[model samples]
Structures are given as C-alpha cells and as structure tokens.
Target chain A: MYSPACKVTDIASLIPQRSPIMMVDDYIIEDELNCRSELAVGADNMFLDETGRLSVEGVLEHIAQTAAAHIGYLHRQAGETVTLGYIGDIKRCAVTGPLPAVGTTLHTHVTVISQVGDVSLVSAETSAENNPILNCRMKVAEG
Target chain B: MEKDELVKKMIEILADEFEVEPEVIQPEANIKETMHLDSLSLVDMVGLVNEEFGVEIKTPDLPTIKTFADLYDYVFTRM
Candidate 1:
C-alpha cells in the first residue's frame, strides 16, 4: 500500500485547479523524476461521458495535473509560491483500456523525462483498479 | 563515427522526426528554418539527438549549432 505524501484536502494548495475542474485527489512522489496521483471519480464529475464513464479528456487533464503537482511540490520545497502551468503539447496519447466509471478511482503515474528551460516533457500512465487505461507523453510549461 | 556516416544518420533521423524531406536537410541550410522548429520542437530535436547519438547538447551551445553541418561537427567531436 502506497501512502500519499499529500492528501486530497491539501491538493488544491499544491496545484492551481479549483472545484469541479480539479482532477487529482492524492499525490505521492517516488523521486525527483517519478510521482503518482489518484483521482476518485464521482457522480458529479464534470467530464463524465454519456455512458457514465470518465471521458478521455478528463483522464488527460488528470495526467497533466499530476505533472503540475510534481513541479508545485518542488516549488514549495524551495519556499516559492505555486506557479500556474499549461499543457504545451501532448503526443502519443492512447486509451489502452476501458475508461473508469463513476465511483472508481484512477491511479496515475508520471515520469519526468526531460526538462529544457521552463518546458518539461513527461510521460504518464493511468490505471483503474489495476487495469491500464491511458498512456501519453506531454509537454508541460510553467506559465 | 565518421563524419559522412554521422551526417547521413542525422539527416535521416531529423527528417523523419521533423516530418521534412531528407532532400531539404542540406548541410549548409539553417536547421531551424528547414525543420520549422519552435522552442518546443527544438527541445524535441535536442531530446531526439541526445537519445540517438548519446550527445548531451547543452542549452548554451544551441546557438552555435545553426546548420546541419554545425550539428554534424558538434556530435562528431563529442561522440
């Protein structure tokens, strides 16, 4: 069992997302290059599809937020305030399995592949109940 | 690696990655112009070259590598 370094209650302070849009609920950092996050899909989730499952866009946002959380954690450790970030680009995104339904929890892992200047390239994989759901590479830039 | 082999490999790799024709990647042509590289794509190019050639391109050294020939020489000496 991997215990989260930051709980859902404290997530908002780390990442710059507010209500309805916030996708991550828990976060754990394995190292400077790797981190994991969790998102519990609820009935009121804004990105739910017509079939009652989380949408692909929702999963992508969750992965981006996971990367944001990693950068935010580093900023906090340096006594700096959290800065806003944007997803500059996404490549090689694929839905590998069924999307998670409401009441399911999404587990996401992020690896920082490289960082050049303010842009960080990261690879992300998300799974639900041990079933792989999505994988992609994203360029996240601090704004 | 020999300079000729390095140039051939670089052209093939860069052309494929940048979605350009190998014919357009001339030795004296400006790399950024030929590849249509923005900052993000330039980073991608750097990462790609690093992966392929095991040459770590420092940020400060980027401006000196303006053409395919420069990039070839850079990697050749480093490798």
Candidate 2:
C-alpha cells in the first residue's frame, strides 16, 4: 500500500501518454532505481479484450508507461523536460496470473536493471488486486 | 578468474543468449557480425556480460572491442 507521490492529474505532466490510451493514473518513485505506479481499469478502457479482461498488450503498455514515468521523473528532477522514449525491446515477458476486470486497479513495480547511453533496461512486475499478473524486462531508449 | 575459465564462461553465456552455436564464437571473430547484433541487441549483450561476470561494459568502449578476443580480454582484466 505505497502512497502515490503523483496523482492522476499530474500523470500527464510526467509521461507523454494522454486520453483513452493513457494507462498509469498514479505514480511513485521509490529511489533512483525503482518506482511504482497504478492504473484503474474502467469499462470504457480501450485495452480490454472480448473476455472483458485487460489484455496482455494493455499490461505490457502499462509496464512501459511506468518505466516512462520513472525516466520522466528523473529528467524533471534534473531540470529537463520529458523526452519521447521508444520501446527498444522486451525480453522474458510472462503472464503469471489472471487478467483484471473493470473496477480493479493494476499495481506495477519497476526496477532499473542497467543503462548504457540513452537506453535503459528495466524489470517490471504488475499485479491486479494483489495477484501477480505480468512480469518482463524492457529496453527503453530516449528518442 | 583465470583467462581460460573466463573465456569458456563468456562463450557459453553469449552463445546461449544470442542463440548461436558455441563453436561459432571464435577469438578473432567479429563479435557483432558473429552474433548478428544491432545497436539494440548489443545492449542485451552488455547486460548479459554484466549480469554473469559483474563487469560493466561501457558503451563508449564498445568500439574498442571488435572481436571475441577483445571481449574476453576486457572481462578477464576487469574480473
């Protein structure tokens, strides 16, 4: 039950996502190498599958945005604006449990594994209602 | 670690991660060419080495390490 340092209203200022596609609603930076975020699932969410559960793509996007928010926060701390970042690669991605339905909140934890140049490797774990849902490593490059 | 032991360990690690045969990792072979690595995949290699050997491969030093022998030397000296 980590408290969010940045609320839904401030999410837009940290990451580039906007509107219906925006996944992260709350964010918290734990330290230089770790962060956490949450996304509240809604019926109108664009990423829901026909089975009425959040799709795998949605989960991956959420993880990616969490990493984006981490990078965004660091840049802001350095007195720089958030830069566009691309998903250079994803590795060891696995769906570990059931997907969330509307009304559930997705909690994600991200750890910075390494960074060389403008590219960073991050490990992400997402859970829905305290049940582990997804885990993966992502490579994000500043664009 | 001894150079022979380090070289043996690196080959097993890199070959498995890059999905190549262990025998293909010759000392004088061009690492990028043998591994078919682009800029993005090159980062994967760096991460693997760091994780397995605890050696941080600096991005700027990448150009200096052209062959498998150079990579072996880099990790051996650092370890």
Task: Give the fraction of reference interface contacts each candidate recovers.
Answer: 0.14, 0.24
Worst 10-residue lDDT window for candidate 2 chain A reads: A1-10
Summarize candidate 2's per-residue lDDT along A5-51 as a digit string, tens digits: 54434988888888888998888878878888999999999999999
TM-score of 2: 0.90
User: What lDDT score goes with residue A41 in model 1?
Assistant: 99
Output candidate 2 Cα RMSD: 3.0
Against the true structure, whose TM-score is highest? 2
> How well does candidate 1 score on lDDT at residue A105?
100
lDDT at position A90, candidate 2: 94
TM-score of each: 0.86, 0.90
Clash pairs for candidate 1:
none
